[model samples]
Target: MRPSIKILEEDMKEKVVLEAMEILEEIGFFVENTEAVEILRNAGINVDSETQRALIPADLVKKSLKTAPQSISLYNRDGDFVTVLGGDNICFDPGSAALNVLDQETNEIRTAVTKDFVDFTKVVDQLEHIQAQSTAITCSDVPEKISDRYRLLIALIFSKKPIVTGTFVKESFEVMKDMLVAVRGSEEELRRKPLAIFDACPSPPLKWSDLTCQSIIDCAKYGIPSEFVSMPMTGATAPVTILGSIVQHAAETLAGLVITQIVSPGAPVIWGGSPAAFDMRKGTMYLASVDTILMDLGYVEIGKYLNLPTHAYLGMSDAKILDTQAGFETGMGSLLAGIKGVNMISGAGMMNFESTQSIQKVVIDNEIAGMTYKFVKGITQRDEPIAKNLLKEFDKKTHLLSHDHTMKWFREELYLPSTVVDRSTNEEWITKGRKSIGERANETVTKLLSKYPGVSLDNDIIEDLTRIMKYENVDFKTKLDL
Candidate 1:
């Protein structure tokens, strides 16, 4: 069932736009890189060479933003299962795993390998609620070409919905192209139906690092939707003020959008960002709060103002590891923001500033996503209509609990908890061995990873993928222990 979206009002959006412009022009942005300073200055912004800042007037910023294509279309192999870039699909992705979270069964934290990644993908395939599978885990098996090789392995394993991925190297971009050609069967087919990759940009102003920017442009040329993530860290990376952060994030996103549009006119793209403030108390960013959640949502508003499909970080927490703090923060933030109709809310089951990943937390987050979906559904009105004719419909003193209608809709109305939770009294709880929620979640993840079977591409397709890997100059899969 699709959730009804509540779009921001036109006037309200315009107000945000006007305010963003004012902030960009008046407040400007603090930039340190002289090369980046030159880029903005050459673009005609008023650059303070001594301060190394770019004070873009509202008109220029608005004009720069106008360079973006309003909407994007993401397609898969066979050009099948294409979803429009915008609207209320509300996609969820796994947490970024440049680092690892606690592994309960292992009794200690460990770096992720290719086996770990394949296991994660297998579990994600079974989740009816998780619409898109992100290229989340880092592959230690093929160290040299991880960016290229893992994407191939995942594509080989799962043939589900569209994938949200990004490439860190030049060959990885070509490796992506090879996988697209293999899955899509032809360059024409792949071109017709492309994937969406998250092109990340360092924030506080619009500046692209060497390899990442080039890779994103390559994807754009091939018609892949590039979801630009402008990660603006408050205090350290960006200004401390939330409003100032918004302007800087906007500028960064708009700049990337322009470059993508230039690479491929009207190519599919997203104005996505997840900029959060630094918690002085904890000294960590991505803190969950009304401010944190709303700030991200508010940026989505600014993005959608351009009539573009938007993405924002949600379902993530500042919790150090998997525990109560993680669960509640995940539940509250994802629950509320999903209710607000955030499209492509990622950071689900992620912790420790998205560097750390947890499978247990992902399961818990799945529960939270399910609950949020239910909350936003509001309530059905079957009883309201039937109540008007209650006397005529039922005999006096009859128990409506046993009515035939009760059996039909009861299941639909209730959100039964998954294995991660318990719905019982003290007596029932004692009888069940009283395992901890985290422990139970660990068992569930192990079970899913063990029992679940994922899609397998043809042998010829696998060979082609391997050949592409050789071209990628990465370690051979046969030699790797993974």
Candidate 2:
């Protein structure tokens, strides 16, 4: 049997859902978009005109849950199937929208440029365990207005993986959607096989902004998947207790679900979030704290209870730099998320309370992800008589090392990591240059980028993508070398 972890029992899950629905029905959620408000009103839900708060009943919540898809299929830019966002199938991608990058040479956090993002995409493209690419870092060279779409453009040019991206404003979605259409050759095909999932976040204490509401509606209309990222800071923006914060998260996510399902009956949606446990003494939000990880796992159980695809911001650190603290937090959270079978695990390379991205950390986290995947597979009986038959052949003259059984199962059972992880003896380490983990990861990054086979896009498609961007008043030719 596959190993797993659970925080809420069957009855506890039911209680969480029931309380969430009650909160939505009584307290209501603030909906800023007029279009969204009208959609809810048309669906027979009560809405206040001045306040824009919609009172969604339990029946509406149940209906929306029924209409929303249980699974979402993501496709690469080349129209190949990548993975499904449901069940116990988990996939990992580097975190998104970091303002700064950890410089390899100086080991200092600085604003990321186009070259930095390019190198990051190339390295992630080569990593074996990181399943998808994200609009990981914003380029300081580009204008703030075009930052969202520009990052997506860079990711598409360098990697073929499906993207996990989001819009910064309402207008950026159409331009980004145009880029996806250009890659897929047509809007119909783009809708048929979605190449990306957009993240739409809800403000804590049960609120939805106009931009995010519009994003959910637009993605639903185009048949693209939308992930609800409800961030609830315990004892700060949300209630002090973990379960209380989860209830708030559920209410906010359920509100978004109602909007999406109302816009399109069978629209695809993911129950995802980036909630953190608040540190009152430091007045900081801890992404890797034990309380925060427990909250993530608990909410995922609620998502599974409702039979929806789930996601969370785990496998990240609160440390400012890459150190023992970074490794300890990242490994613990990542392993638990893997065991719990979160469908889309983000925040692989993020640090400093999710404000920074580290290339070295990403390389090391790739190894951690590999081990987590192996651990979840668990151990199985390899032979009919268990180990008795193999023990019979394990004599003094012929050791198990030379036996056929050892040769057959050793490679399959063991998860041999890359050079990013140290597995050498004392003498071997001294002879081969005792490099730090960061040093080895830096070398791996350089090697991967040096050997990366660049993506080849058709000239026509490239021109189309460029034209779409140029129409938005940003000239890529002047700023970047295409």
User: TM-score for every candidate vs. truth?
Assistant: 0.84, 0.98
Q: Please give the range of 10 consecutive residues that has the lowest summed lDDT in model 1.
A: 473-482
- Against the reference, the lDDT scores of all candidates come to 0.66, 0.91
TM-score of 1: 0.84
lDDT per residue (tens digit) for residues 130-230 in model 1: 66677767766566556554655564445465677777665677777777678778777676766545556544555555565665567667777778788
Residue 241 lDDT (model 2): 94
Q: Record all residue pairs in model 1 with backbone atoms less than 3 Å apart, i.e. clashing.
A: none
Instruction: Go through the candidates in order and give the clash count of each.
Output: 0, 0
lDDT of 2 at 164: 95
Off by over 4 Å in 1: 1-79, 148-152, 155-159, 383-386, 390-398, 471-482
